[model samples]
Target chain A: MSLEVKELFKKYGDKVVVDNVSFSMPGPGVYALLGTNGAGKTTSIRMILGMLEKDGGSVTWEGKPLNFDTCNIGYLAEERGLYPKYSLMDQLRYFGELRGVDRKTVDERIKYWAERLAVEEYIYQKKGKKQQSPDQLSKGNQQKIQFLIAMISDPQLLVLDEPFSGLDPVNTDLLKGLVREQIAAGKYIIMSSHQMEAVEEFCTDITILHRSKVVVSGNLNEIKKASGRVNLRLKVEHDISSFIRDAGVELITEKEYEYVLKVTGDDQANGLLKSLIAAGIPIVKFDLSELSLHEIFVNAVGDEAKEVQE
Target chain B: MNDAENIYSIRGIEKVFLFTVRQTFKNRGYLLSFILFVLVFTLMGPIQYASSQAGRGAAEKSMSKDVEISDVENVFVCDQTGILDESVSDLGSVDGNVSFVSDESVVSDSLGKNDIVIVIKTNETGFIINGIISDSSDISNDTLDVVTSELQSIFDDTRMKKSGISESDIELIYSGVSVDDPVKESDLYVNKDGGKGKENKIQSGSYGLYMLGFAMVVFIVISMSSSYIITSVTEEKQSKLVETLLVSVRPMALLMGKVVGMMSYVVLVIICGAIGSTLSSYLMERFLGIDKSNYGGSSYDFSIFTSFGIVNTLFLVLSILLAFLLFGMVSGLFGSTCNKTEDIQVATGNVMTVAMVGYFSAMVIGFMDNDTVNLLAALIPPFSFFTAPVAFLGGRISGVILAVAYVIQLVVIVIVLRVSAKVYRLLLLNGNTVPGIKSVLESVKGA
Candidate 1:
């Protein structure tokens, strides 16, 4: 069973928001939807989830039209919220109920997630004292609650849209661990984020949107390989700026004795390494790898105006 | 089994319903308002009642005082024609305090102490009786009427005896007669030809029910339900919680559940207010001797059902239910288009205006009892709900008209639900304000 969104399209009057957007998730894994602001990543995801009316396209799960009735879908929206004046447990229970979980199950799930998300204190609160509303909790703690709501249903498919927004590193890592566990349990996840490093760490497949169009998409490694292995990082005890220059490689950055160079191919990188050794500079670290997800994203969607004009 | 297969279940609807109602009461602002309402009505009932009783009591007391004063005052009778010579001896039979006087001076002197003077003179065909008393005295007109009527009856009897009229004939002439009415005004006309035992008399309790019912709808729909629905929807929209919610529940299910939930909360409030007011009035009357039945403006009698009849009572209940549903759903539609809490009023302002128009129009027409206004108001969707009760109670509308109005509302509700579903689907996921009805309609059509 897989999720397939084909030829999806959306528009507002003459302004097209998502044009012919297509992607497929063959099985349980994270599919990263990477894009700059207003690239229609959210719009496409909404259409795929059947939350929005599409201009044209079909979204299917296992060869049948996909809908809330056909598959259990958990969504962590870009703009997260809990009723500011309500208890955290109440809202979580409500969300669970929406997903067809009974009260007993909802209560159980709330307890489990509250403990896992480390929000048990807020949920249980003090017996006599008034329970805290969402607004009373710290921004990070609220984000944790939001995550707990999305996972309370234990859905088979999860869509996280900027799930880790506005979180400190510790909280981010905490949520990331939970997300990794879901994937291990065979949850099909579609994630959209500005944090490319996080995407690179989790997403096996990716679709990079640039101005309502897919500029790059496919297996993450394949897309990175397509971007080419033209970037190199090196560290040495002595200065290697002169060797990099003589080897005809473009010096991108230098800090003390360390240097980053851009190369056309492996030949240039090898020559640079050889020149550095010939110069009697002790090679501390040498690495040749494909483009980082960040670099690839920048390359794909960097020139927004140019891409739109094209 | 996938989650989607069981998504159409009632468990979600039930949860949302319970959550919303609990939240409404749990909200301190709402709870305070409800408490204030109960106190005001409960106290108002007995206070108004007591004042009315006091006024009636004062009038009754004044009447008894005048009777007592009249009983003590001496009645000086001056007989000029001598037709009352025999009757003068028995004047005490007429009133124990009366005395016959032949001198005019005695009659004139008795006026100083608010005493009465009666002079009898012969007219061409009968006796003339004149009564004189102090103008400033607090004498009741009832005493004077009884005195004049009694003298006239005596003169008639004396003349008949002198004319040799038969006693049976005199008895026949003075006997009281009355005609029994078989057809009531309401049964004849308001029932529209459904004669015999089909009277739609507006009982005393019906008015109280109408007043209570109208106030409940206005308060619940305008102040509580509309605000609650608008705020809830706006909050969800602004916070984008709806995006996740829609995945599990349909827009219709979510909205209608809220409508029912908020309505139940309002009903609970109304019931509480009624019980509280009743209990307060009872406690006041029982413990404090307030005599609420005499003082209370309208008795809090539950006999409205027996008075209004089963069919009419059903109409009343249905009208209220339909009104709440129509207004509640309208508020929901408007609420969905809003993107922020502050924008809620702006989004639902026109809808509220429409509701308020119906409410105020009903209030005016309720007292006016205008057939045209009542019929028109009853035909309009929401206005029909508010005005039908007034029209029915005022006898401005017939049974047929009432039924028609109810049917119109039912039809309007179905259509509104359909259109609302479209608007809800579009606006729930929309990131920006819908701006106006034109765009919303366009979106609904497009969807």
Candidate 2:
């Protein structure tokens, strides 16, 4: 099944919050919605989910108008919360029921997710005993419960906004495993997060929003490839600052026996390597890597700001 | 994956409705408030009855002391006609404390110490009778007339005896002379036109029912259901859960689910209150023998509820239920618009003020019994919710008027619900304070 969002637009008064935000995933995969604070990522997601009214454009799933009634979808909002005074089990069941999940199935899914997410101790209650409320659980555990609720329906289309914002490393990995599992199961997913490494780990296609506008978008690898390989890492027994300077390559960093250099392409890296080898530098390691998603995000957002300033 | 494969089965609104009701009952504060209200309402009738009874008893005691009808018994008579002794002795039914003086010279002296003195003297026409009473005696005119009638009867008897007439003839003449079918005096306050006028006085028990009904509306519609709706909506909004839930259910469905669910909770509370109070009051009167009448010193006729016909009772129940639904939906809108807990309070507080106006106006007009005011209050949308029942119960308005008022209320509620659905959608994702009144008004206008 395909999920297509075309030219979505939203505005608050005269200030546009999401403008011409467009993308599509023809098959099950992770699509990342990346942006800075107030960058309209959340607004775009809301519009896509039909939670917020779109000023312009349409979102369709499998050639039909995308809506709650038309499609089964799950959403994890960035500002995470639960009924703090209510039982975790109850809230989960309620969320499931809202998504049209039957009670028996919801209960089974609750048990499954609780065990999978390692929150069984907090969720299950003894017979004739009062269940624990959300307030009784820690913040991280509450987030686990929130995740459990979001995934309880086994939705085909899952939208997560900052799904791991306040999670610890172990819990984050636990959630990440479930997300990967869903992807493997051929479930269409869209994730928005500030963690670039996490997005890069799973997301294949991405749209980066900056100041309510799309700055960089399309295939993750293609965007990086177009930006080019700009960095090289070298570790040697001796300091290579002079050889790097001789090669006319800009040294990005030098600490102890390691050197990081900026280069234009493979030719410049090969020329630097030749200069280094001829100089009889005992090179322990030489590695050339493309710009990280973090660098690419910062550069794209920064370049947009510069353009605006100009 | 095919489109059908992506579809997940969802439970109907029954699940949400059940969950909401269970949660409300689970809330200790709501439970406590409900119980407290029931006990208070149950005891209201007995307490009011006792106080009125006490007042009635005290009034009867004071009334007996205020009138001195027995004081006129100390009357003295001087009969110089010589036939008065026989004539007066023949009148066996005269209850006056009359004593004859052997000496006429002592009669005037007797008047100073006694209440009054009467002298009967034989004359050519018939007999001359004169009465002397002290100005300070304070005898009422009715008491004086009684004494005068007895003396005149004695004179007529004396004349009839001299004319050889019998007592039977006198009885026949007097019996026929009396006016038949005397017109009873009535005040202007009475229902002079015999129209469907307001009952000038309602039975105490009926008044109590009116009060109970009014309080029920206030508690269910304003206090309990509104607060529940607002809190539930705001809680979902705060947690940002509404967005996710919206994707699973339509905005209208979600809103209606929440509202209908909370309304069920409210109706349960009201029913519990009604049952608890009724059961407690019954047990108190039946087993405990606490004597509800003793507590409520005055005697009351049957309860107003008892007098109501099936249709009236049905109307009462339906109107209140509709009114509550309307209130729940409107309050849901308020909660949806708010961004924080305090904002919910402020927003609902405005609604409460408006509801309070209707509540108090119903009460004031209920007692005033002014036709214009009652009609106006009963026909208004929400105020009609309170006043129409009261007017119907008190006989101030007809059934047709009440039905029309309910129709108006239904129309207003339908309109509000439609507008609220739109507002609910607009404000669900909005995290900012939705510019309260103006924003909703504008949205409604746009719709």
Candidate 3:
């Protein structure tokens, strides 16, 4: 059985947010959702999760309507909401019960999560006493609890919207590991994070939302490769405006010791290296590859905006 | 199922439920206040009861342990039938104490001197009495007439002042006659359930307690559930937990879990309060020795309410409680549409309005004692739970009707639960703070 979100669309009085989005999401794997700001990535996720009614099309489990009885899913919104007044253990246990998990198991899971997160000492602290209302926990700790809530149920589908927003690097890595643990165990996770590097490290499949539409999707490597914009970085000795004018690329980031060139779709990358070599330019080094997820997302959004203006 | 899949299944959701309960309790949430409120209320029951309890035989006791009345005296002379007494001169000759003359002419003059003068008159139509009652009287001062002799004589049945009077035809007088009640019947009978052999009286002092307890339960339950629903909803929406929660249990379950959890405290408070009140009432009656029977109970009939009848009524109320559960869940679920805590008040305010309407209806039904209120309340879900009890308490509704009303209430609960569950599922999943009633209603109607 699969989650089928078909041709889903959402609009708010002429401002279309989710545009005819469609995806047959795979079960039990990590799928990164990449997008720039205002890309409607969050909106698309809501439509797919059946939280918002799509203006068009339907979301189904296998072939039936995605009713509550048929499935168990967990979501950690971008906001990382937890009850501030509820103790960490209490909140997690409540989320567990929400999924129909029994009382004993809820307790055991609370202990496990409390211990895992290393906050077991404060498990019984009155939220008021500790001032640990959901609002009280540090961003990272709140994210930890959010993760605990979503993962506590071992949901069939786990949706994480900006899951790593307020997390520090160390905590981010910890979360990364926990997220991987869920994925490796064949637990389906559809996650969106602003941490591009983190997403690159974990995602097998990726979907890029640009202006409420799926601009680029499928395999991460493929989408990056399919961006059709090759990035070439050159270490320059002097201002290479003269050399750059001859050719090489349209997208360019010329920084000290590093000049990034997005060469168009062609085998001209090797020829550019030859031309630079012939010009006697002291190129420190060169790294050639398809566009990064960020670069691809930028280009996708740019192109979509251009299309809208046109 | 394989071990790997079930591990998350068993471990995940279960953890959430217990964690919530623990969270709720640790926060000194509903449980603490509920216990305190109940204890206070229970203690209040006695306070109120002390005022309402009837003045029993103890009221008749005229003498204190340390003192005696030297100027007054009482006698049980069976002279209503005018049997000749050999020592009439001896009664009038008591130096300090005065003797009550049974004759009207003698009684008028000696009324000032006598402590008690009970006259028994036996004519054809049962026995009657014409003895004068004075303000200066003892609680235990009753005219006694236990005649051991078999000879024919006149007797007065003074205590049954309004007996055989058409109960319906009784006038709307301000004052009610005094009657003592031995409330706890060790063995209950189904004989002429109400207004017959025994009727439970609500004493004056206890009246205040009953009213207070009722108000406290009404206001507090609404208060607890109100914030409980609004805050929990807005919190979930704010944190975006609604989506995760909706996936596993249907919005109804999450709503149920929350309100149900809070209600556990409400029930606890009520039980504790009940026990406390019982003990307090006893204490007040013992120590303060206040007689509240002066307030009311000229006419009382618990025949409309029996232990069995109460149980049946209680069964109906349980249905009402179930209805409250749904109401709370729905309120919470609906209120959560707001993305922020600020907007929660409005959503829950609407909920409060609905709850208040039900509470008022219950109070009105309690005082007015109408069948329509009972019938309508039973069908209206939340209102049914409130009004049904009032109807039963007032003895305006029968056990059969109560059962049926509650049964109807129970069905409404199921229906409300199902619908609210739907709304919960749809609305909770979205963390949109501004969706408002339009979206919620659409989801409910759309579903």
Candidate 4:
């Protein structure tokens, strides 16, 4: 099924938060939505979920308008909330009831999750009374429960906000694997995160939000190539000021000994290499680097927008 | 956490609410305190009753107001029931009071004299007698007024006769003494109409307990359900569970679930209080052996008290239920709006204030009749239930009227729930504080 968001606009009083945002994201694979803080990323996610009313716009899933029924689609809001006093099984079952899951399955799924999450010891406790609370669990464990709350519905489209947050590296890896598992099972996954490595590793398609507008989006590699950005690394015997004065290449970073240049445009890097050699700059090693998602973010939303406007 | 990637549904939100309530009750600190406190207070019932039986003040004053006959008392008495006969004479001689049921036995009613006054028995209604004035007794005019008011009550009764005299009877029934001269020199602070007697502490205790039951029911219903809401929402927000649930289920549904959960809590507390009250009252009556029927009813027959008691009990129960529903729903709506436990504290704090105001206002309204609160309370959301109970207690309203008020309040609650649910869906997850009172208007205006 296709999700289409057209000309969406949201205003907070006189301030425009989501301005004429438009997108058509067909799911079944992870879609990485990227943005800086205060970039209206959260606002747009809320609008897309139909949780917040837009000033003027439309969001349709499979050509049907969004409403309570469309709510069957799962979501993990940017700020997740679970009953602090809820136990893992109790908390999961409670949400399962609201989602209209069968009563019998709630227990089954809860058992499954408890074992899978390795939180079984925490369940079925007679500590005080009949119930357990989420607060009794650790934060990471709480996040695990929150994740299941969104995923247990087996929603056709899953929207996760900062799923990797508060996760240790190992747990993050575990969740990253889960994302692929969901995708392989033919579930659509759309995740928003500030982690560039995670996005670059898993997101097949990406959307960058800046100042309440989409600045750059689509296939990660294609977007990077279109900007003519090539990651470069170099090793030199000595610092050469004359070798640095190149027409089509710019330094990306300079360590104490070696300078790294970002070469742009076709043939620009080859000609720069020759120019550097003719200047007798001893290059020990050089290789084209892979583009990081952060560079892409800075390219699309950082100084590029300012330079273009000027 | 590999298997943690299982599916969840919005229906789980409802389960969460119920689970929270059950756990709250199961919590040892609160439940233990509540049980212990109520039990201790309940045991005090027997102690209070025993110590209060003989104390006298207003008890004596009010006692001295009802049906006192005296002196040669020439008892010209008649009774359709034939419960008393001629040997009952000191009859007219009830202590030292005499009556002339002759030409002047008649007294004026607001509707003019229709042989309304009864010295002993005149044309069926009780006593019709005029006391001859003696210049001697040192009682105040206020006492005379008290005697007149009580006599008015006795004369209106269709079947009362003088008899069954006891040694202590004379001391309690001497309100009006005949004196031609008015004592204008001394100042009287007591109500001109209410005339004071020795106030009976046990009787006052009885009234206080009745009111205590009322206030407890109201406070427990509102507060218990409200605390359920606060803790429930706070936990949800804190655990980040609300985010996903907000997507699949509407805020209104979540709100409804919470309201239902809290409603269960309120209902439980009310039932408990009712049981406690019944037990206390039963114990008090057994121990004190009070004949409070005369203190409260319009006639010695006590049929009026019985009928009024039934009506008041029914209305009290129903109004309390409706009022609790209204309060729980509104508090749930507001509680769900907060995004953090601390935020919930602030949110429910404001909600608690409203409940407290409504309850105290209701208590204050109990002492006055025909105030704006009496009229306003019949329609105001939470206050209606309370005021209706007070009115029923005063015998100021009929069951049909109370039932109508209850139905109207129920209808208002339904409307509020429906409208609140709709708006709640849109606003539940927003991190900003909604302007409290104006939110409804803003929703209606869609602004």
Candidate 5:
């Protein structure tokens, strides 16, 4: 089944919030929505989920309007919340029931997720001990509960906004593993986050929004391949500043014996390496790779800004 | 989306309702309030009865002291029922010449202007005690009343003792007398205008009082339930759970669930209160020896139910339900516009204002004694919910008018729900700022 979003638009008075933002998941995989702060990423997600009214848009699942009736969706919102006074178990059950999951199934899912997310202590009560409320647990644990709620119904499509914003290293790894499980299980997922490494690790396609407009969109590998392997990390025992200048490669940064340079393509990098060898510069390490997702995002935003300036 | 989708979107309301109710019962504040309400209502009747009994005893003692200081020179007791002897004359602190006469004629002939003849006679129903004074007696009416009150208190104690009955069992013995059956004043008044005289009908003054009382109760119940609705609705925004919830269920469904959920809690509390009050009343009669029969010979008329029968009562019940739903939905609408818990008081105040207008209008129009204004008030919404039931009971409006008022209220509730559903859906996601009227209106228009 395909999930398609087309010509999504939203505005408030004279301010355009999300302008013609559009993307689709043609198959089961992770599609990333990346943007700067106040970049309307959350707003676009809300419109897609039908939580907010769009000025213009259409979101469909398998050629039907995407709603609860047509699609079983799980959403972990950016502004995370659980009822502070309610029990974690009760809140999960309530959310599960709302998604039309039966009680027995919801209970089984809760038990599974609580263990997988390592939040079983907060959910299950001990002898003579009160059940834990959302407020009583740590923020990370509460987030785990929210994630558990999102997955309680075993939805076909899941949308996560800032899923790893405030997690520690351990919890982050745990969540990432569960996300991999979902991918392996062949579920359609839309993720929005500012963490470039996580996005790069999981996302096959992406749309980068800036100022409520898309600055970059398409397959991740193709976008990187188009930019070519232009990043060169070279380390030599001696200073080769003048030799790097002779090779005509743009030097980006330099430390004691290491040089980070920008090259036009693989030929330029090979030429630099040959020149360094000819100069008797002992190369301790020589690495050439394409731009990372972080660099690509920064360059895309910078280019968009330049175009707007022009 | 189509209308069918919008209408069918409330599929998950049952889950919301159950969760809300369960959580509410689990909440400490609500549970405490419920327990306190039940406790207070359960103790209400016994407390009032005990206080009134104490007050009556103190009043009797004070009046007996006043009688002791009065100028009456003689109290002649002619006991014909044989329940009292000459020692009964010493029961009061009269400080006058006390005499026991063998015949009533002897006391009548010997009675002077400063003397009162206490003659006790047996009757088919009970004993009758007469306090007779000379026609030219110089005693004031206040003095005579005090003396007679003292005598009555003394005789009551003596009669109970003579019958070997305890003070607590007096109410049971007097229960044989059918004084508690309420009788309508209209039934006793002769209809001089061939039964068509409105004046000969139930008095407007009493009806006004009844309507005022009924309106206060309805106002209280609606205000309380509406406050709960408002609080529940605002909680979603405050907790930042609206987005997650909206994905699972529609906005209308969420509002409906919370409203109905809180309402169910309120109804439970009300039922508990009723049970407590009934229990209190029963305990007051059974254990405290305090029954309505002891409150002199005055009759209370529950003529509202008796005069109208079951049909009008059902109409009244339906009107109240519709009114409650209307106000509850309005509360939800206003509450959705709020984004903070602090704004709940303001929302509650707005609801109370609407409720007060209905209550005060019913109270004011109920006393106007104008048929046109009464009929109009009984047919209009808000006011009709408060006034129509009582107006029908008072015979100020006919059953047909009451039915019309019911229909009007139902239509109003439907319209309010429609508008509220749209407003609720629009405003649930409105962030931290509380939206003003213009924004709400705009949202409604867009919806």
Candidate 6:
């Protein structure tokens, strides 16, 4: 019931592409692998899925090697691919059959997914017209077909790499909803994306890689809680720049009498708010929140870059 | 990972095979090419026969128009063979006074300047018709030739009539006469002092042509099928479907499936070709009254199945299949090196060069009439695939040598498959231009 990837490593000649990456699922949930471009996110996913040769370590499920025999797995690769000249229905059926799904079930699943993803017209041929090929469909539609192929077998473990890269907002929401459903159905999923908010919405645990090494790895909530509430948002009716200077607060940004500040803890925030009240500034808004996933990712990667520079 | 794990697996091969076959048939270009292949093979014989018949008719008409005998005043016929009658003088377009003479010497001496004497005499081989004209006669050579030709035709007709052979039976009588020096069954494959024993010179010449022809056919079949394999492999690569496919099936399985799938198409085309050729032969014989056996002036007893019997025919078929698989695998290996659709032509060219070398070498060596060279060529790969079967059927090489050639071909096929599998696995994910020999070697080493 758990997927474990331990100390996975990959190197090409003198370049270490994925170095000592490790993580585990422990249960049915979404685990996110996030990093900047060329940060080894896709590489780690490829190694875990056995698509690429690993220089070190093993990927195991339920204490055994993870493979097609041990667990039914689905992979949505970063690079979207389909037989451009082949019919979409034919490609989907072929993928389903390759994964050992029977024809009847494959057709049923295709029908279900085609309808659910709103691609039935492209997949099913009308009276005399030809079935649509991948090339004939738009790129977003082609991606939907690829996604359907990954889900046709209804695999227990699914790995999606950059699943939302080129999708428009509407299609992105559609995919996000499907991921949530899979989570609800108790399937183990690993998703990698540059869209931080999407990852934040679905992932319970995460590992952030920078320059081929993990900089942050833990449950999302625990990581956020440990960092504490350091972001302060304040909105006032009048200018409070002079009182903010007296309280010695770090001014991150200001716009139209509303202020965004950084503080060490609640004490600093309380002191700033107390001064604002005593100065008789009408408090329109005062909010304290933990760091967003985007901020956390930037800070972690930024710190790593500074260390490398030093 | 072990070598077996990395390089050998058939899991999910059937899906790959079926998909490849379905897509290939769906491709309009491939379907059109297949139809054309069958049509050409089927119509080739009939077309050639009809053209040759037309050429013969035109030649006859031209010859008749060019011949003139109006200057001759008389034609004296001496029927020395006793087969011709007084009607022999009326055999041609001669407007002269035609008369039969009793003695050839007296008639020949009495021939005037404008007269020619037609003498029909029997030799041991057959009748010999000679036109005799006086040394001072003004009769032209053309006139003499016309008279001689007319006398020969008359003599033939009269002789056939005297012998009671009907006109309809003339074709049967003049049909191809096949000569064979029968040897004991065990002596068929026995090479007596490295010499061809009891081999008819004419049959050997025909057999050489047959060998060359068969080698061309093998070259064509392998080349066409290998190109299909190359295209199929590069299609998958160019579409960037390798990663998704690798998860479902191993590299070797994918390659094996595609090769077998394309070969199945080749087999279908070959069957169609056989049907077309058979149809053409039937059409020629039934409608044109032309018999292939008699057309070339030599017996066509060179059919592999008929000449070598069933066992060797099976062996020949096996060698052909192995040869096809070997070439197909090599093509797949080259195709794996391709990263783009543009690389397909170069990959196909590399494999075709190997096939061309095999085909031409077999053709050139097959015509040499040397048993040792034929036997050696038949035991070598690439060439053996093309030459061995025909050589064995022609008795240029013994059965043992052919069997040895089969063994060598199988070994070569195994080696090629292994190498192909290794290269395919190593390079399936590589996204670069077609790799060179050094890169391939490096990849192989790493694998």
Q: List the candidates' TM-scores in order.
A: 0.81, 0.76, 0.67, 0.67, 0.83, 0.86
Clash numbers, per candidate: 3, 9, 47, 55, 0, 1
Candidate 2 CAPRI classification by DockQ = acceptable
DockQ of each: 0.44, 0.37, 0.29, 0.28, 0.45, 0.50
Considering lDDT, which of the candidate structures 1 and 3 is the better prediction for this target?
A: 1
Q: What residue pairs are clashing in model 5?
A: none
Q: Which lDDT values do the candidates have, in the order given?
A: 0.74, 0.73, 0.60, 0.61, 0.80, 0.80
Ranking by TM-score: 6, 5, 1, 2, 3, 4
Residues A1-310 of candidate 2: C-alpha lDDT, one tens digit per residue: 8998888887766788888988999999999999887889887887788766677888899889787676778788777778878777777888888777888999999989888999997888878887677777788887888778778888889898888878899989988999999999999999998888988999999998998889898999998888788789989998777778877899877888888888988889999889878878778989988988888888889865344334
Model 2 alpha-carbon miss at residue B188, Å: 16
Cα RMSD (angstroms) for every candidate in the order listed: 6.2, 8.5, 9.9, 13.9, 7.6, 5.2
For model 6 chain B, give the 10-residue run with minimal summed lDDT: B294-303
Better of 3 and 6 by lDDT: 6
* Tens digit of per-residue lDDT, candidate 3, span A104-172: 988887778777766565565655564445666677777777777776766777788877778788887
**Candidate 2 chain A weakest lDDT stretch, 10 residues:** A301-310
Of 1 and 4, the candidate ranking higher by TM-score: 1
TM-score of 4: 0.67
Clashing pairs in 2: A100-B9, A100-B10, B49-B296, B49-B297, B50-B295, B50-B296, B50-B297, B53-B297, B53-B298
Model 5 bad stretches (over 4 Å):
A303-310, B1-8, B58-62, B69-181, B184-193, B196-202, B286-289, B293-307, B435-439
- Model 2 / residue B369 / CA error / Å: 4.2
Model 4 chain A weakest lDDT span, ten residues long = A301-310
lDDT of 5 by residue, B1-447 (tens): 221246426788899999989998898988998898778767766666566678789998876554433588887777787766567555365557777777778767656878877777888998877777887876656666666667777777777878788877876765665544545555534553887865344477767766776777678678767877878778777777888998899887887888788778777876798689778777667886777444422222233544456876676666666777788778888888888777888878878988999989977986786889889999987888898888876777887888888888888888877776666766877774463344467777766
Work out candidate 4's RMSD over C-alphas.
13.9
